[model samples]
Target chain A: MIVIGSESRGSVPNTSPNVRDMAQVSCCQLDEEEFRKCCLQLLQRSEELRDGWSWQQPQGSEDGYLKKTTLRCVSVTSKRSKKNQQDSALLIDSDCRQNQSAHVSAAPEEATDDADDEDVADDADVPACSACESSFLQFEYHVVFSCSYSSPVLYFRAFTLEGRSLTLEEVWSSIHPNFRLHLQENPLNAVSQQEHPLLGQPFFLLHPCRTEEFMKPLLQMAQQHHRSVNYVLSWLSIIGPVVGLHVPLQYFSTVCVKDPASSSNPG
Target chain B: MIMNNDKDVLRDVWFGRIPSCFTLNSDEVTEREAEPYYLMLPRVSYLTLVTDKVKKHFLKAMRTDEVEEMWFEYEGTPLKWHYPIGVLFDLHASASALPWSIIVHFKSFPDRDLLHCPTNSVIEAHFMSSIKEADVLKHKSQVVNDMQKKDHKQLWMGLQNDKFDQFWAMNRKLMEYSTEEGGFRYIPFRIYQTTGDKPFIQKLFRPVSPQGNPHTLCDLLKEMYPAALTNDGEQKRYQVLIHGIEPLLETPLQWLSEHLSHPDNFLHICIVPVPTD
Candidate 1:
């Protein structure tokens, strides 16, 4: 049964050509609380992925097929989308319900063992996690793949803000509010007609791991040397060839906070 | 003697020093022919100073021709110096004795290879000139004669209108500035090399508005010169100016800088020096 509801595109009136093509990850059947919770987890997952941590299964296991759970894919079919946008966001909800029904149905037919059902439930409860879904999506079929709802639709929109055409990153940040909204709204839509190459002007993506431990020293160093961390970090990225330093943003952030002068900041 | 690896060797020399004052305080100072004089404390990477008198006397005596070699006891261990003049002078004049300490100060130069070191206080020079009014008419005829050598379509497309003339004029102005007092001259040397291309080292440059005041320039320069520049809450306009432009940057900068007035225009003519021996 297809349930269609009123989906407001929100206050940002400008629509991205790519957005129409991006497969709409089914935001269906989820109540307000479930939707919110799913989004929160997605945001947290984005942070995790940004920090270089991969989603992986816990060790010492067997028959990983037992770990299989289904996720509902919502293909936002716009002519611009490159692939059918799959909604990994609804995978956990679907998989959990599927497993629950299976266990209920299987309980009566096979009176094999009490422990077996518990184990089956446990295996079935794999919850269609972010890492798993992403791995599955790596296969050609899944446009938007990932077990966990971390990797959302790749949304692309353009607007003139502050007298300049907003970059993809800037628009993403502005529309998403914080990382939470980004988790719920997978913006990268697949193109139905022509392949949309993801390329645009550069903008800063707020790193998930930014902590006081890192930024304080950096800010202090900036004040001392009278330089900005953004400038320094950007310079470091460019100068890597000349300076021969693998200055990733996280490392730069760490160095900045470690500066002694950072201690003087008013918290 | 030429210090093979000046920077690395200097670091070793500064950090690997013999502590004299602590030994004397422990009553471990043995009665020898020459007593230990003063301890050397570091003030900067290139300089150090003596802090104690006994270590100084020992260092002074060691420098003399009379004493071929002198032995002293520190921490109940016998130590001897054999004409270690450099260490002795460093100990006496200045060593490590600052708030941040010399080690911290020297930390800034690790990425700055020796090639960047200004060998002498001298300015280097370069010159380029645009064809004058007399040369322009003659140059046009010569251009027609040399049309076969040049890409006709490209040349015509580029010089279709007065825009090309404006560009030529602006380039002439830049050439003029480059030939002036503070301008590009010395090519960057490298610490190492794979091929001929030298890697570019990043140096920050303070932003100067067209009508920027001297005060603003100084402030911008202060932040720009540092390897790390951070934006404070206060309004500040500064940019990272890449050194040494490569052919790869041509199209990117054309799109990036837009008009010559944009900050991206400042990137042209930057020379990224290779950091090799």
Candidate 2:
């Protein structure tokens, strides 16, 4: 029973004015300026993340204005759920072949077996035979700051190697079952295709209205422990996995350094 | 009397109409030439929610196999169905000749440019999400969170059915604020500009200043978008529009948020270049 957004604000125990001011400074939410600074820091550190993600500012915009960070063509593998497999067999058999061929060039070893199975299972109960097998998917992820919510939002879209976009149902099927169950329970956290605010392109985004609700506890815990955590990294670690964008452990090790203020506290 | 004036402004904003002509894209393979569909689009309503007639009108001349999810484009740019009709018109075609000529497509739905509104339920969900977001800004979600499921539904139904009284019955509660607090915690608004690829400008702007003076629209523009305002003696380059009309710069932000906000409860302001001619 997770209360979302400002509804949960009243339930939390009241803190002293000093603590409240601390919470305001160390709160999970970021203003546009803080979001931009954190994004620049994330790009500067984390060499691996840097390879995948790039900051994109719209042309003819002044410096220090709105910009989106993008990570493109991240490959993911997920075992197709039984229902999705059945639907794919009936609806996209030919499309699967084209995608499989494209995947072969990208990953020859894994795609070969899957491609062979897809060819044979065209008329069979493919779900039963290839239940354990996985499908290769390419996903593009964008981290855009939502001004209304004052939070960074994850907008991503999954596509086949052949370039056909996955519908929302197909995306839901690809989610890790653990996160999928949680997302299913909370309708606000559900992923839906929305127009990319900057590009005006259609991309699937997890609703950001409740981001502060979910991130608050994690941030509060860190604040209490005197751990200075990167807002973008911590926030991304929570949400990235839901959409199959796993944050690498190297990111934490490489980028996060203890703050000088927190250094006085003994481990 | 102030309440009466506010009610009148809300009604005018709700009932504002843009007469539009939706023409089928010339490239669409049709059994017969499709006639251009014409309708007076409700300013506060979503394009996809209100364009069923336009879809049906064009579908008559097209083969069932050739039709895909219907999409609308103005000039060359694909119109996002998620935005309110008035926002789209004001941003792209404000100074254009009327009835606004919109190109409709049945094939090759631009997957990149537009979100798919497969059913009215999608629009409902989007609409409800927007109202909740606005409430989060206005009352810290207190007013809307206190609402029952039916109250939420009534708000949606009112907008969907175009029943002004039914909507205001549920909506007036959302627009409420304690007199001691002056107005909403923050004014829920989005400033749209036609020039850039940037979607829109949104930030936490309060209706009243810290000193308790009521902030005007000019104050918001000055803080969020200084360029939209002309410097002393400079030629006016932009026209700031809300519901196809420009309110005075001196209008209080709180009054505008209450009266001019769409059913979703966000004051959508569009800044379009003034006609050079």
Candidate 3:
């Protein structure tokens, strides 16, 4: 098409409308180093439940009867999936959570190098795996279910989470009947002495890194553009052919469906 | 142009051809963590180009060695010539996606050593006017060859699956349904390959395949230059070297002319006729 040099002031020929729209959208550039610092700052501000995990104040409940707390899965992914879809949940050991709490309470300025030893592969070419030697295709998605060393019951629904919208029943059905997901963040339950106490049943471990600073703008971009994070990723991927060159960016968003149960439905 | 002494030796070293690892910066590493070689060392490869008019002026300015000291603005920010080489490389690489930067010089040429010299080396001359007709005939032969190579069912399946679409599309009529048949005659630039003093017309038009294999570009170039070419009176004396020749409705003819003016930027390698004492 005779696309020459860096600056030609015309519409690129053969360019799709969706691709051109994405090229115009701007995104925040976050490197691995910046991500690490943001994560560490969040951990220090909240109460650490263990080495890599932390909890914040259990806020007022949505229904007034159910209190909600925020769990920051640092270097850890909260197994937030149903039992059948249990591979997606965050599995935190009790000792790890206790250690996390102790560390958070200490108010240590020195961030530990070994806080939650989970490795997340940020590249599409490479897949995240438990072991380094596994093939790229061999890696499987894991889910976090409620505490069961035996018949592992999963409560977090994975399907509804895909586009970020779900009904209260969808969330309720996904949760184990024994464990109620309290909106409160206090690891120490004030009503621990109550009969038929909820223990071992896992609540969805929401990521603590959600300051809205990173996501709010991304959501705005997606909404204003009528696109999804998946759509953006797909859009960015096509930039190679546009100018007849390859340009890679660090920041990208994933199209997410909020648990209609959670009320942040993207759709 | 005079970054280092012994220009002849440097030219010869390039002519010998080092491995692609040392030259092009495309070696496979164990973990894709950091490209140590690309990050640390300068990947020096001979980017052979034929110059036009305006580019020749810029080259002359660069050779005066004053551009290296001049404080010029890039993207509105004033940057000096001696800023890290990485900065220029990075910006250019990223800017590849963006439109080409229009260089508007407000000042005069630099006052350094005049080491820059223009050679009368020949480069490939792709006559954009002839490509459409030639491509049509070439594809017809290719289709005949493919039929002989494969059975009827396989050929039908390949066509149905859009496998041969690019090949056919390249040779197809662009204005088939238009009232003005042959409204846009697809003419490609004549590409010339130059080595030392002599320039040769390139036989292969497209360096890359539709499947995106970069190695194929190298392979095509290698196939075109099977043996080392020496520049002598008996060999071919090529005409003016040009860049970005692919014929379109509007030609950025100035770009080629601008690049040709600068002798330093486009070093025309020519064998010395006499050994100076």
Which of the numbered candidates is closest to the native, going by highest TM-score?
2
Docking class of 3: incorrect
Proportion of native contacts present in model 2: 0.43
Better of 2 and 3 by lDDT: 2
TM-score of each: 0.18, 0.80, 0.17
Order of models, best TM-score first? 2, 1, 3
Q: Write the per-residue lDDT of candidate 3 for residues B5-108, one digit (tens) a residue.
A: 43343333222211111111122111222211111211121121211233333434332322221122334433222212222323222224323232323233
Top model number, lDDT? 2
What TM-score would chain B of candidate 1 score versus the native chain B? 0.18
For model 2 the local lDDT of residue B213 reads: 87
Q: What's the C-alpha lDDT at position A204 in model 1?
A: 18
lDDT of 1 by residue, B35-98 (tens): 3234443311111112224435444423232221122322222211211222222222122332
DockQ of each: 0.01, 0.26, 0.01
Between candidates 2 and 3, name the one with more favorable TM-score.
2
| Candidate 3, superposed: residue stretches over 4 Å from native | A1-7, A15-18, A46-172, A175-214, A217-267, B1-277
Q: A1-267, model 3: which lDDT tens digit per residue?
A: 221121223543432211112122124333223333333332332212222322221122110011111112112324555432533433222111111111121211112224422221122223233432221111001111111010011112111111122222333333232333442232221011100102211122222122123344764787798764432222223321121111123222211332113221111
**Deviation (Å) of B215 in candidate 1:** 31
- Per candidate, the number of residue pairs that clash is 80, 0, 78
Off by over 4 Å in 2: A1-28, A48-51, A62-135, A254-267
Interface RMSD of 2: 9.0
Any runs in candidate 1 off by more than 4 Å, and if so which?
A: A1-50, A53-77, A80-267, B1-166, B178-182, B185-277
